[model samples]
Target: MNKQDRLNIDTKCINNNSLNSSQEIQEFLEGYEGYQHLFLIGFESDIGAQNCESRTGQELGPNNFRALIEQLQFPSSNSFYDVDLSSLKLAIKDCGNIKPVISDIEATHQKLESFIKQIRELSKDSIIVVIGGTDDLNYPALCGQSAYSEKLNLIRIDPSLDFEDKYRKQFDDLEPQFLEHHQSHFKMTLGNEIILEKLGEVLFYGIQGFKIDQDHLDQIQTKLGGKFQYIYFDRDIRKTMFDIQNQEQNQCKASNILMENRILKESQQIELIVNIDLTSIKAQNAPGVSEPCPAFGFNTQEIEDIAFNIGKQENLRIFTISEYNPAIEKFQTGNVLCSIYQHLLLGIGERLKNQGQVIVANEYEDIGQQELEQDYFMQQAGEHLQLQNFDFDPSLQDFK
Candidate 1:
């Protein structure tokens, strides 16, 4: 693909400077060496479908999401004055979309992995946000971690566990492995012994019990043993607004507590990759996903809260939003998608301020050599430790 063909967010969204010259988010687009917190990339590929029956049109997800970001209004100081939204915006560099070789998915995965490695080499601290065509895109995101070799705390916010007992065979056959919620590439990537050997921890959150294959989860849990954490699904989260009034307790708060504790502390830079499938949400809120379910999933606010919480982490190396299909609900899904992305920025900005690292426009573009060296050191140290293949202690499962 030619460089010109690669799509990115239009500059119009960031160019709004009605307040002042320095106030606009666009003023902060410092080339590579700056205070940028995110590198927005897209993976526009949907070749992983098992058949035409499962779903299509997810390939349009990235561009649709970009359009939503462009159309939405930016937040004001009244909403998030503590965080430097302008600086955060300046730090972002949309690298454009990666068009996978649809005929050969293996080649597509390799191309994506290579691209992610190049980005990691450019900046370790910057979060990589990969807008995906489908859930299979998560595999490439996970594989991208190999570039840093950092111990990862993979957090999957989905309605059901995507674990397959015979994942190895499915992968070998190159079948449409991730067509359904039950059979997903995540199963092969996260449940694989080879993959787990390199991971520090894996946690599954917001799972729906009825949708999952209990036997498959059991087998994966046994394999992962202490390396995994499962936050079981409770029916209360699926209650409608009216039903919530009758409920005795707030289910969201309970889940939030777990999310709050899991935020990677600055002291231990455990690499975080959040894979959020739009299907994880209630059908009413995300009807455009590849496979929407009316029966089980979190409400809009709950998923947004979860996304915001994940975005707030200092060690969030990668964040992927997948399976959004504009073909389903068109504008309705588009608006929901925009809200999710906007809230994520707010959360990240708040955390940056709390960490006492509020980025100024000028400070973003002119990063010093000392700062570069520190980032490099951290990346190297993480790679070295990953090579050691250290076993995660069972005590790390405190969230359980």
Candidate 2:
């Protein structure tokens, strides 16, 4: 296998040729409007159980999982998004007009490229929400043709940065592999074409990290013009707060870490691709991740608070939650799955036109939209607006 390459993910657990309707999942995939949203999960790792290892995290198995997909469909409207995908040969049969396209192939690189191609072919405007086997999938997931990718943005919510250096030994030395790797064995993906490219296609990538990657930081800096983002959950924030407080001289480090994400958000108009990993939450609260890092994920209240902020961002192109596995050992994992689903589901609901009324604004002109320092927030959410918020409070003393 290539360095960054592995076998396509194994998804043999998916037995149905179609989705089974249920209540919970239906709510999760709630706001599809004929536009497609693909949820690719990295269930093969620490989160992906060999035989249901530790079922303490989130689980959206085929049953409720189908409901999640269905919820993404139009509210009996927005007909353009309703694509009949039975022909795609996915493990699930009835994924609504949307089918459950799993990348269970042994060739991970092949699967990744194939899935991206399939998504591009299925619909030009579809949204791919990959649940993810690992964080590495983000770049290859964008391997579809570049013009199509120009419309794509990445949004990742995890506590750690998937630094290129972190997993150097995982496969071959893959940093250089993408430039030299190509395969043509996928017969069942979207467009049925074999193509390859590295990183030119994506618009913007949004990553929320707790323990970030230096390479990722570098990319965020150089690629994003020094605006890669990371969101520390309350606990991680508190932890950083404590660490900084305990430090003798470098006291500003703690304050900088705490304010890093918002500061990045404040500086630039981030056209986004939203990728969320539940590991950003407390592992005790969410345990089914492939890798349960100590400093990731949000508290119960933090989920929606962050999602609300994300939903409020205008430049968001795609929103994905990675690391959900249901066929594991415990049941709490399933509960967390339900909770996180509900969180993103609520975010989608907020954006959906069918779920009653959407409070669309030119920009947040309300006084409440102003920063803590009393600066106003500019137009943000979905790409039409250059999301700029004028936050003048450099010091907490300003707010005090």
Candidate 3:
């Protein structure tokens, strides 16, 4: 890949013959109208990863993952008629990659911020799945989300917490950091006063204790109090798995760690971003990340359950998969990531289907129309029109 090459939407992706109806995500090929639950966006810059001197080839992540997705078969809606994926009318689109200005990484993030803001404005209900160049990309991703929601709940699944207190010093310092070294999302977000103030809650799962300073973690925990909730380390997760695997009888009940959390329940009512760092997985399952500590991560099944359950939430706005290095793993990691995608899509589709609402393209259109109508009605009603003019009881306002 050319380092200074400007990013552009690869129209070749939409025209590819590999994406046939029987195989691949058919909805992606059907124009923007068919997309519902998920919209995948790619980024071609691995600048962030390179800054950390961790690895390169993250720029190739989107293309490699897309190539894999194109060959995989879509779930048969007919076979699972009971859940009725057909009725749910799920759609997923490849919105193409965010191309940055020629040789400008900050400009690239600016473009991403604009793209995310546009997507949020266009369709707040649709869930966006960002295929990132690195975890640092999460900064711009959430910046766009901040445009719409004042406060957001972040659910981050990573083996390591990316918080550098020095990076949080000044907003102007970010561009230099982005250019120089790999910046952590935690540091970047906190670095910006706007994002920090807007962060209502945070949950860190599958964290690698060895990668972070315990004092820094405790300081953040104490600062946020209830908002900084639920830290599940790799060891705790392994313990759960150990217990489940050891149980010969009544094993099914013990294996219900996916959707059984209080923090997850609260996350459903607000704007939530589910970020999965592929490095959080064991090296055996995912060797494609920029930084991989072989035996120090979650297994495939554990990651899948976490993703699936998080995907099931109704208010999930964005799902990001980051730190994937295609050149490092040589396509082996895509298989596991693909399976996780399957679980996530199925969980999301089932949730919408069970709720008896297929919220996608047309639903957004209806919302737009309703808002327009409400605006017109409000204008005609007049804001200054008093309750006494309509003979309203004064006591009614005080009832609540």
Candidate 4:
């Protein structure tokens, strides 16, 4: 198919309505009046995995995730966390899948980049969640966001670093058959100077040290300079989690590894993009990826925590979950992904609530003393009280 034809949204999964009357999320789909808080788009392509000679079937990731998520039921008010979810009124829109050109990888990237640019321009305030076919799609996602942002920061959660230096003699000597597919997986790395120029800081989280070549690591370090930081699977992640636990108990200062890495700092002003490769999780937890880490990786809960923390960042612009292959999946990976998405949404809700409070406080500060007459003050107080009583739709107030 031509590029324009490929840009059409696949709505098969979206039109499949839930049968349960009590379904909370299904009610928020696409017909809301105000701004949508979340926009879900799928990049449907396994050509990257095919080119890289890894297992294919990630092309089905988006629809598979949707089929499972549609079955979920929101917790009732009497449950453990007894908050009234119906009152939140969050809206989510599934824009459906972007069909990819199998024969031309570059064309696929171009189509995705253009489509993402449109989404960003159309709804600058919305959280854009991309369901990916493979990690290579991350390159286009980053490019699309950088078009509108002056400075960008990236956090890549993966088991092995995907950097491969083309200039190295070892790389130059490789056979053409091996070389073509090998380079398909390296687009997200710093091998491209254009991508490097747009990035202000980058963190390679959940990296397995043994899986990386020493030369590739050294090469990335040299190119990235002080802008690069990494958290190792064996050495650092566990300790970071321990530090976070201690901080929560008030036994130590409030510091997190992400905070130390500078990605989660609320004061930072850069637009952030997070790319999560499912293979970063242990094989037992996420066996449905192109490449599974059998020996060591993050557990499901740890990955959920990471997602929530990343979501809470005020500057998070785009979040991509990639490398999910349903062909080899053992039935649990889809559920794990759905849980991660829910946690991320919760984090976003918390951020919005905090910002709403600040906005209310600022309005109070802006009131002039002369205007605070007895009757006027009472009227103003009543309005503020009414604001508290109003149905809280986090998307109603523009945080931008």
* Total clashing pairs for each candidate: 5, 73, 4, 0
User: CA lDDT, every prediction?
Assistant: 0.63, 0.38, 0.65, 0.65
Residue 80's lDDT in candidate 1: 36
> Candidate 1: lDDT of 283?
90
Per-prediction RMSD in angstroms? 13.3, 19.4, 14.9, 13.7
Error of 3 at 167 (Å): 8.0
Segments of candidate 3 deviating more than 4 angstroms: 1-37, 74-87, 101-103, 165-181, 241-255, 357-400
Give the per-residue Cα lDDT of candidate 2 at 35.
24
Q: Write the per-residue lDDT of candidate 2 for residues 289-324, one digit (tens) a residue.
A: 555655444565555455544543434445555555
TM-score, per-candidate, Cα-based: 0.73, 0.48, 0.74, 0.73
lDDT of 3 by residue, 90-116 (tens): 655566676544445667778677777
**Candidate No. with top TM-score:** 3
- Show pairs that collide, candidate 3: 36-91, 51-182, 52-182, 159-208
Error in Å for residue 87 of model 2? 29
Between prediction 3 and prediction 4, the one with superior TM-score is: 3
lDDT tens per residue, model 4, 1-400: 2222221122333643221111222333333334235767787888776665678898888888888875664211213222222333344556666677765676778777776776666656567889878777887788778788877888888877776532212435575443323233443546566778888888888788887777877777788888877778777866656676777863321124655566666336888888888888898998887778888887897787677667678788899998888888936888888877867766665565455422233323322232234348668877998988966453442210
lDDT, candidate 2, residue 352? 45
